[model samples]
Target: MVQRIDVECKNESYPIFIGELPQKLEFEGSVLVVTNSKVAGIHLRTLLQCIYAKECFVCVLEDGEEYKNIQSVQRILETAFIHKLDRQSTMIAFGGGVVGDIVGFAAGIFMRGISFVQIPTTLLAQVDASIGGKTAINNKFGKNLIGLFHQPKAVYVNPFFLGTLSHREKSSGIAEIIKMAVMFDKDFFEWLSMQNLQGSSLLEAIMRAILIKKEVVVKDELERGVRMALNYGHTFGHVIEKETQYKQYLHGEAVSMGMIMANRLAVQLGYLSVDEEFRIQKILEKNDLPIYYKIPSMESFYQSLFLDKKNENHQIRFILPHNIGRFIPCTHLSKAEIMRTLEEFCDD
Candidate 1:
């Protein structure tokens, strides 16, 4: 069965359809397909078949997070301007997270907002990025430092695209898959632990991962409170991305390591059981993820945490794990405690 998830927004809601992507879907007005060169090489034919618009165009960007910045976003804007895209015009974000992030943000700011559709090709995008309306680009300041929350008109998840992913990329996506399982559905986590994690089973797990994230996003579209829990692995993940200058790790790979560090920190804070901590590590290690990195100091990360849009002030917020299916928005840790956490991470 193709499961459908609905996410609420201020003006309206959107549908996330999971299963094999359909060859065609009916639509109105002009439609533009925004994709990356790598993805277009693989699926442009099928995408062209699926789009139903009076006029259709394709905008291809180079793949990679490094390209998901103001420069790229401007290209999309230029394309829209060249086409004289109107309010009735629709755009499809037709690739992984980077494509979705840039294109979705394009939909938000272009002529004050146009209809955007998400055709997520990567496992990470399918399970998480494509569903949420949050679109953004990275700057020298930090990752996703420039962005907006403009929800897609629809999100289509197709497991067929999984066939093209490399083993390393597949493993990277599994990290986010496992993260969703661990943060919102303990039963789902257990199910994931049993899977062989290669073909259809991996795809099924990916959809299940989306299910977990969808439920939370529906409740908190703007991330006022509960939805922030979806960031369980991202606190340290962001810092890791910064430290590596976004060159060393994929988003999901960094997140895999981030979640492990968060789970371990939870144990130190007297929340997680040692057994649970070990289980988390085992899951990451089984997928070949590293859970630790040495930093000269927490000075930059600490500063970044405060600057994080999610935080109110110098006090940083973290979505700490309470159990397999629960997390709490905690800002109780003093800077001293944070420094100690960094110290211990370095020592380990």
Candidate 2:
């Protein structure tokens, strides 16, 4: 059965179709399907078979976070140019978050902005990255520093693709679900703490997380206010990704640790109780998500916090749990207070 959620934006509204990839995705104009080599090997043929466009093209990129750069974006543009795709054409992002971001960015800049669809295969992309209309590529300074808010025309999330995901990939996706629960739904959090994260239970969690995200995005499409709450664990998570050069941990794994760090700060500020903090960590651990990261240098890590895109006015905004089921975007904390929290994560 296919479930649908509509994401209403100021200029347009699109549907998130949750189910199998339709047998045919009819498009009036030419189509460019961008993905990575890894995904191509696994599911490219299946995706191509579903496109009923006037003309279709494929651009398969290298598979890895390190390759999410301007070069990759250029490669995609080159393919579009070679294929002579016009503004009327639509680009299909047929992979995980990395492919979706790269393809969305490419489609956004192509002809100064065109239409694209997201076919997010991994759980991470399906629930969070693919829905937000936030497209970006990483640079030397930080993750997602170069990109724009280019919303896709639609998003197709096929749980069938989840069958091919490695155990680690599924665990990574659960971390995002956990973040949604910790920030907006205590009842969901409690429910998640008891589930084993398999089959029907996993699909239910994805739907719940997507619903929460849809509500937040519709309210603040540009992330001017309450939408900032969605960054709950990303500020620190991006730093972790940068520190390790996006090699050691998946984005969600970094986020898992970041959530723990954020919770630590929230507990310090008396916003979240010790029991609540423990509960959050326990749920994360239950899904095999990492909950700890040894800070190499508190000072350096503190300095890097400013590089995050979320920081502004020379202040790093932190998304912290206001106990369970609520969040607060904090920019008023002194450097000393943040440094103290960083020190706690340092190795003895």
Candidate 3:
């Protein structure tokens, strides 16, 4: 069965199609498929068989967050240039979030913006990354610092792709769903706590999470206000990714640890209860996710805050939970206080 959700944005409206891939796919104009080597080798041929285009090409980059940089993006542009692709050409992102991000960004800037489609192959991309038009590449300074607000023409999410993911990848995607539940839907959070997180239950959770995000994106397409809440654990998660040079942990793993840190901060600020914090931690552990990290020095972390895309007027904003169902956004805690709270997260 296929489920569809519409994302209404001021600039463009698009459908996110979730379920099995249609037996045949149709498209207009030239087409280019951007993917990582790992994904291209495994699923590219299957994807190609479904699409009919006058001109079709594939560009495969090396996999991982480490390669999500200007260099990789340039390669995409070079491929487009070599093919002489015009504004009418469409680029299909056929891999995970990193591939989607770079491909979307490429389509944005190629001939001053072209059409792009997302065929997200990972759970993380299906639920979060593929829906939002927030395309970006990581900079030396931070994650998603360099990018654009170019939305896709459409997003195709096939759960069959999940079978290709490793155990760790599957769990990583669940972390994002867990984030949605914690920030905006207490009922969802409760629902997840009881489930074994398998089979049909997993599909239902994905839909719920996507629905929650769609509501937020429709309201604040440019992240002017409410949309900032989506960055609940990402504030610290991005820092974790940068500190590790985007290597040690998957984005979801860092986010899992980041949420634990945020929960602790919420407790410190008298927002979330200690028992609640433990409950969140227990859920993460139950999903086989990590809950701790040996953080860097206070000064290093302090410096890293400046690189955050959400920083306004030199004050680093955070999204903290008031409870399971709600969030407190744009909370600018003092450097000293942040340091004090982070001290507890260390591996001493």
Highest-lDDT candidate: 2
Flag clash pairs in model 3: none
Could you give candidate 2's per-residue lDDT for residues 1-348 as a string of tens digits? 899999999999999999987888999999999988888999998998889998999999998788889999999999999999999999999888999999999999999999999999899999998997999999888999999999999999999999999998999999999999888898999899999988999999999999999999999998988788888889999999999998899989999999999999999999999999999999889889999999999888898889887788889999999999999888879988998899889985
Ordering by TM-score:
2, 3, 1
After superposing candidate 1, which stretches have Cα over 4 Å from the reference? Answer: 1-3, 8-10
Q: Rate the local accuracy (lDDT) of all candidates.
A: 0.82, 0.92, 0.89
Per-residue accuracy of model 1 over 201-282 as CA lDDT, tens digit each: 7767876777778777778888898878778788888778877888888888888878877887787787778898888788
> What lDDT score is found at residue 250 in candidate 2?
92
Reference-based TM-score, model 1: 0.94
Q: State the lDDT at 29 in candidate 3.
A: 82
**Tens digit of lDDT per residue, candidate 3, span 1-348?**
898899998977999999888887777788999999999889998999998888998899999999999999899999999998887799999999999999999999998999999999999999999987999999888999999999999999998888889988989999999999999999999999999876899899989989998999999999988888888889888989999999999999999998988888888888999988988998999999998977867578668877888888888888898888898874578887888777887655
Q: Please state the error at residue 46 of candidate 1 in Å.
A: 1.8
> Candidate 2 or 3, higher lDDT?
2
Question: Which residue runs does candidate 3 get wrong by more than 4 Å?
Answer: none
| lDDT of predicted model 3 | 0.89
Model 3, residue 201: what's the lDDT? 95
